[model samples]
Target: MAEPRFSRFAAIDWSGAQGHRHKGIAVAVCATGDAAPTLVAPPGASAWSRDDVLDWLLCQDTSTLIGLDLSPAFPFVDQDGYFPGAPDSPLDARALWKMVDDASAADPHLAVSSLLTDPEIRRHFRQHRDCGDLFPGGAGRMRVCEHGQRTMGLSPTSCFNLVGAAQVGKSSLTGMRVLHRLAGRLPVWPFDPLPPHGPAIVEIYTTIAARAAGIRKGLSKMRDAVSLDTALANLGSQPHRPLARYDDHATDAILTAAWLRANADRAELWRPQAMTPHIARTEGWTFGVS
Candidate 1:
C-alpha cells in the first residue's frame, strides 16, 4: 500500500476521571511537517471536559490522523470475549463501543463510570476501589498489540486494570463512548475502514512515540523544556515554545503529535505483521506499534 498523506496530525492525552473538567486531558496538534506541536487550551474552562474533546474533534476540518491516547476496546481474542461466559458479549469492537456508550447514555459528560461499576460487568474489571471477583490477575489480559508492545520493551497496562498511576482502564473505557459517537464522522482504524478523505482516529500509546524519539522507558515523561525539546529533536521536529507549566500530560501530547507528523507516512506502520483481520475487528492495533 502507498503511504497515507494526512494534512495534519493530532495527539490527545485523554483522561477518564469523573468530573466536569479533567486536568489529565491534553490535546496537541501540528501540520504535516516537522513543526512543533502546541497544546490546545480548553474551551471556556481551565480544564477540558470529555464533551469538550468530542466537540473539538468533530469540528476539526482537515485530513488529519487523530491519535487518541487510550484503548478503544478490551482484551477480546486472548479471552475469546470481553465479558467471558456472558451470553450478551459483543460480536465485535463496534458492538462493544455501543455497549459502553449505551451504558452511560444518561450520565453527564460522556463518563463511563456507570459502565465500570455496573453489577453485571464490574466482575470483569480491576477497578481502583476493588478488584472484581472474576478479574484476571497481574495487570489482567493483554491485547495482541499490547503483547507486541511488550516485545518492543514497552509496558502496556490492561484496559481491565484501572488501579495505580499507570492505569489506562478508565481512559480506554471512556474513550469507547467517544469512539462510538465518532463512528460515522471519524472512522476508527482497523475497526472502521480508512476513508478516501477526512479525519480518522487511531489508538496511540504515547510511550511508543517516546521510544521512537530515543527516550528511554520509565523516563519518557518529559517534565521540562530541555527534556521535551531533546525528545522532539530526536524525532526531527522543531523545538516547542515554553508552556505555562511543565508537566507530563502536556509534554506527552506535544511530543507525540510531532512524532505522528514525522512517522505518519510509513506504509509499514499501517500493516503490522501480527494484525490479522479478526484482531483488527476486535482489539484494534495501535497506530505506531508495528
Candidate 2:
C-alpha cells in the first residue's frame, strides 16, 4: 500500500478541566521537513481554551494529521451501550457524542462532570472520592482497545474509571463534546471517512509512541534533556530544546508529534486487524494499535 502523505503533523495533549483556559492542555506541531516539533501557544493567550484549539485547527491551510491524546468513544461492546439498563442508551458512537454534547450544552468549555447526575451512568465509574459501592468490577468492564493495550504491555486505564490521577474518562467525555462540534470540519479517523484533503484527527496514546521510541516502562514522565532528545532522535526528529521540568503533557505532545510523522508511512497502522466495522463505529481504535 502507498504511504499516507500529509503536509504537517500535530498532536494535542487534551484536558478535562472546567475552565476557559487550561494549563494542562498543550499543542505541538512539526512540518514535513522540520527538524523537530515545537510547542504552540494559543494566539494572544498564555494557555489554550478548548475553543481556541478548535479554532486554530480549523484555520490551518495544510492537510494535517492531528493526534488527540484522549478517547474518542467509550466501552460499548460489553453492554451494547454506555448505560446498559438505562431506557435511552446511545446506540452508537455518534449517538453517544450527541448525548454528551447535549448534556454539556450549557458548559462551553466541555466540562463533563454534570453527566454524573444519572445514577446508572455514575454506577459504572469510580470518582476521586471513595465511591466504594459504585466501582464496577473486573476487566470485562473495559473496552476492547483498553484490553488490547494491556496485551501489548501498555497499561491503559478504563475510560469508565473516572477516578484517580491516571483516569482518562473525563478527558474522553469532554473530548466527545469537541468532536461533536468538529463533525463537519474535522473527519476523525476510523469513524468518519478520511478526507482526500484537509485535516484528519485520530486518537493517540503517547505511551505507545514512547515505548516505540525506546523509553523504558515504569518511568512516569520523561525528564532530563538526554532521554527526551534520545526519544526524539529515535523517531528521526532533530534534537530539540531541553525540558525545563518533568512535564508529561509537554513531552507527550512533542514525542507523539514526531512519532506520528515517523510512522505516517507505515501501511499497517492505517489498517489494524482488530479494527472491525463495529469497533470503528462504536468503540473507536487508537491509532498505531493493532
Which candidate leads the pack in lDDT? 1
Clash pairs for candidate 1: none
Candidate 2, RMSD to the unseen true structure = 2.0
Worst 10 residues of 1 by lDDT: 1-10
Residues 1-290, model 2: lDDT tens digits: 65457878999999987788998898999988648898887789878988888788778767899999999888888777877777688888888999988876777677876776666667767777735253565532677777888888998887877766888888999899888888777789889866778788999999988998888898737866777888899888898766545478888899899999988767788888877889889988898887
Q: Estimate each model's TM-score.
A: 0.96, 0.93
Candidate 2 regions exceeding 4 Å error are 1-4, 130-135, 138-140, 242-246
- Mind giving the per-residue lDDT tens digits that candidate 1 earns over 83-182? 9976698989999999999988888888887787688798888876788888979878999999999999988988889888889988898899998898
Candidate 1 stretches greater than 4 Å from native: 1-4
Provide the overall lDDT of each model, using Cα atoms, as 2-decimal numbers: 0.88, 0.82
Residue 97, candidate 1: Cα error in Å is 0.9
Which candidate should be chosen as best, given TM-score against the real structure?
1
Worst window of 10 by summed lDDT in candidate 2 = 131-140
